[model samples]
Target: MILIEDTVISDDVADKFFVCNLEKCKGACCVEGDLGAPLEASELPVLDEIFPKIKPYLTPEGIKAIEEKGCYEQDWEGDYVTPTIEGRECAYALYDERGVLKCGIEQAYNDGVVDFKKPISCHLYPIRITKYEHYHALNYDRWHICSPACDLGKNLGVPVYKFLKDPLIRAFGDDWYKQLEREIEEK
Candidate 1:
């Protein structure tokens, strides 16, 4: 199985072309929740180690949510959203009275308590990496699920959905962008 990884979608790549009002965006991806990721076989040990620390509040519903692995195409039966375990959102989700996206990961990064320490799955939103043959197709994760912050950044200016949406294309030059997009279409 080939996995698509995002390396170019970060400000490092988008910044080369456009400035981002990340604060303005408010990190809606994290706010939207859906932060729980299934523990891969290799991740089990790490999660097991961390479980005790976080287990007090861990719920069966939260565990079930990861198993569902719902995605953009997953059936969302109306009524606001289909029934989901753990409310199908990130653990750090919150909104101000005005309703804006706020992410704890970025806040932690800004506060210097943590830096680039979030789960890769959490860091890579609106972006993913899928491998094909010997090459990888770096792409954005555009599920159209977000708050006004993401909506504004995506439409008004340059903003990479993920920290590493694609390997800095500059490292590979313009041709890499075309090549990655081509992989997406083919797949």
Candidate 2:
């Protein structure tokens, strides 16, 4: 692990490559996970605030899940996460005519409905974060469903850290990301 500021980042972030192949995976990460996308405590209010704006874009089941279970739910691990539809797709997930999973909150943000673009966890996908009393842990999550993305990323020579620049910046900060890049380059 490489220590940057208060965070310990896994070497896989720089050693492994990954780029989402939406056509191949069909956004399986959003739909196949055992639980909904994890949410930071601070994000609960944002989810609530954007629920109405994204409601129209969600599926009927998703809307009902949100209405009945609230915008977020606590998992067995005691982590707050977005509500899922029948314990499957995320409540905020929508699908296009092609059946590809999409995030309603992100769509709303793109359409200028809200400034927050979904959850930071969703944005920093494949890289799950765990907070500790002293620092945070950043690790890459490998899944069989993402093999196509791994192949594509390898062919394109984009490492996970490089591929997720925007989200890393969103999760940490500009300075932290710059420091990480510098450390990677120095190595």
Candidate 3:
């Protein structure tokens, strides 16, 4: 583990390679999970505030789920998460013309309908964070559905940290990411 600031980062985050192969995986991570995308407490109000703007990008099913279940729901562990469509795909997920699942919130953000670009947890996927009282544990999440991504990342010579630079910066700030990069380089 590497410690920087208040985060304990897994070695796999630096050693393992992963870049999302969306065409191959078809965004299975958003669908195969038992619950919806994990959300931070601060994001709850953002979802509520932006629902109106992102609604147009969402599918009817997703809209129904969100309307029925509210903007977010509590998981079995009592963590806040986006509601899912009948406990399947995230309610904020929509299938594109190619049948690949996409994030509706991100779509809206791309179109300038909203400023927030989806949940931080969703943005920093393959890197799940567990917040404790003193620190946050950042770990690489290995899933069968992401085999293509792993293979591609290996071929492209991209480690998990590099592949997720933008989100890491978004989550922990640029200085923290620079510190992480320096630590990885010294190793």
Candidate 4:
């Protein structure tokens, strides 16, 4: 799948350091964009095998994304929403903990689809690291209800080097990442 290139992008991963005060914001993250984070081409087969039986039950966009293995099939600048699961109008159409719409994939996993797991990007939140100049930097992109888990500074006090590298390895793999590692490290 082709990654929708974002030239102007967030420097750090948005990790939820604390369980976001989501109730206050009411699951704003779910409405923000595609709920699932980036997935590797290698991971396509897993969903292909599972989505068919459940395809009709999924939202039209969700089904299309599964087929393409591309999350943002269209440019989701904003203004998108899903039909209420039980009864409510959430853009992403996920359940609310009392009120706020939660991630659709997470809720789907709870309903069933036991094999469902978070994408590598989702697992590593607010602590996102990307190649910036000669070095890597940690960024707190969405501090609000978007990614409350991103503020790891409290426990870790800071996002250490390994935190950045491990996820990069998972996202890009050993060889591709090694190139990036060399680019940043050796210079």
Candidate 5:
């Protein structure tokens, strides 16, 4: 493990390779999960604030799910998460013209309709953060659906930390990410 500040990052984060191949997986990460995307406590109010802006980018089913279930809900574990469509796909997910599921909130952000991007959890995908009382543990999430991403990353010679630079920086600041890079290099 590599430690920086209050976070402990798994070695897999530096050793593993990944880059999302959306064409191959078709965003199955958003649909195949047992629950919707995890949400931070601070994000609940943001969801409520941005739901209206993102609604137009969502499908009727997604909109209905969000409207009925509220923008976010508590999972079985009582952790906050985006609501799913009939407990299937995430309620914020919509299909692009090519049939790949994408985040409506992200589309809205892309269009300058909302200031907030999608949830930090969704942004930092394949890296799930577990919060403990004292610190946060970051681990690489290996899912079968991400095989294409693994293959592509291997072909492209990009490590998980390199591939997820932007999101990592977004999650833990540029200075922290730099420290992680330096630590991995020293390893």
Candidate 6:
């Protein structure tokens, strides 16, 4: 494990390589999870506030799910998450012409309808964060659906941490990401 400030990061992040192969996986991560994208407490209001802006980009089923279940729901684990369409794709997911799942929230953000991108959890995929009383534990989530990504990453020689630099900085801040880089370099 590598320690940076209050977070303990698993070495797999540096050892493994990954870059989402959306063409191959078709964004299965958005559709195959047991639950919708995880949400932080602070993100609830943001979801509520941005739903209207993102709604236009959603499918009818997605809009219906959100309309009936609200923007988010609490799972059996008592953790908040985005709503799903019939326990399938995330309510915020939209498919492109090729049927690849894309984030409606991200589309809206790119269109300048909202400032917030998708959830930090979704943005930082393959990296799951668990918060303990004293520190946050960061681990790489290995999923078979992402095998193409693993192949691509290895071919390109991009470590998981390096591939995820932008979202890591977004989640942990520039200083924290810089410290993480330094620590990895020293390794």
Q: Between 2 and 6, whose lDDT is larger? A: 6
Cα lDDT tens digits for candidate 5, 17-98: 9999999999999999789999999899999998888889999999999889999999888999999998899999999999
Off by over 4 Å in 5: none
Residues 84-174, candidate 3: write the lDDT tens digits. Answer: 9988999999999999999999999999999999999999999999899999999999999999999999999999999999999999999
Task: Write down the lDDT that model 3 would get.
Answer: 0.96
On lDDT, the stronger of 1 and 5 is 5
Kindly report which residue stretches of model 2 are placed more than 4 angstroms away from their true locations once superposed: none
Better of 3 and 5 by lDDT: 3
- Quote the RMSD, in angstroms, for model 4: 8.5
User: Would you estimate the TM-scores of all the predictions?
Assistant: 0.42, 0.98, 0.99, 0.44, 0.98, 0.99
Every candidate's CA RMSD: 9.5, 0.8, 0.6, 8.5, 0.6, 0.6
Which lDDT tens digits does candidate 2 get at residues 1-187? Answer: 7899899999999999999999988888888978899999999998888888888888898999999999999999899999899889998898888888999988889999889998999999889998999999999999899999999999999999999999999888999999999888888
Give Cα-based local distance difference scores for all models. Answer: 0.41, 0.91, 0.96, 0.43, 0.94, 0.95
Model 4 lDDT per residue over 31-148, tens place: 5443334444454455445555444445655454444533232225342123232222322234444865555555556678645544444545544545446554444455455443
* Tens-digit lDDT string for candidate 1 (93-134): 334446654443345445564433334454444445554476
State which candidate, 1 or 4, has the greater TM-score: 4
Per lDDT, what order, best first?
3, 6, 5, 2, 4, 1
Query: Model 5 clash tally?
Result: 0
TM-score of 5: 0.98
The runs of at least 3 residues in candidate 4 whose Cα sits more than 4 Å from the true structure, single-residue gaps closed, are 1-17, 33-36, 53-93, 131-138, 145-187
In lDDT terms, which candidate is top? 3
The alpha-carbon lDDT assigned to residue 4 of candidate 6 equals 88
lDDT of 6: 0.95
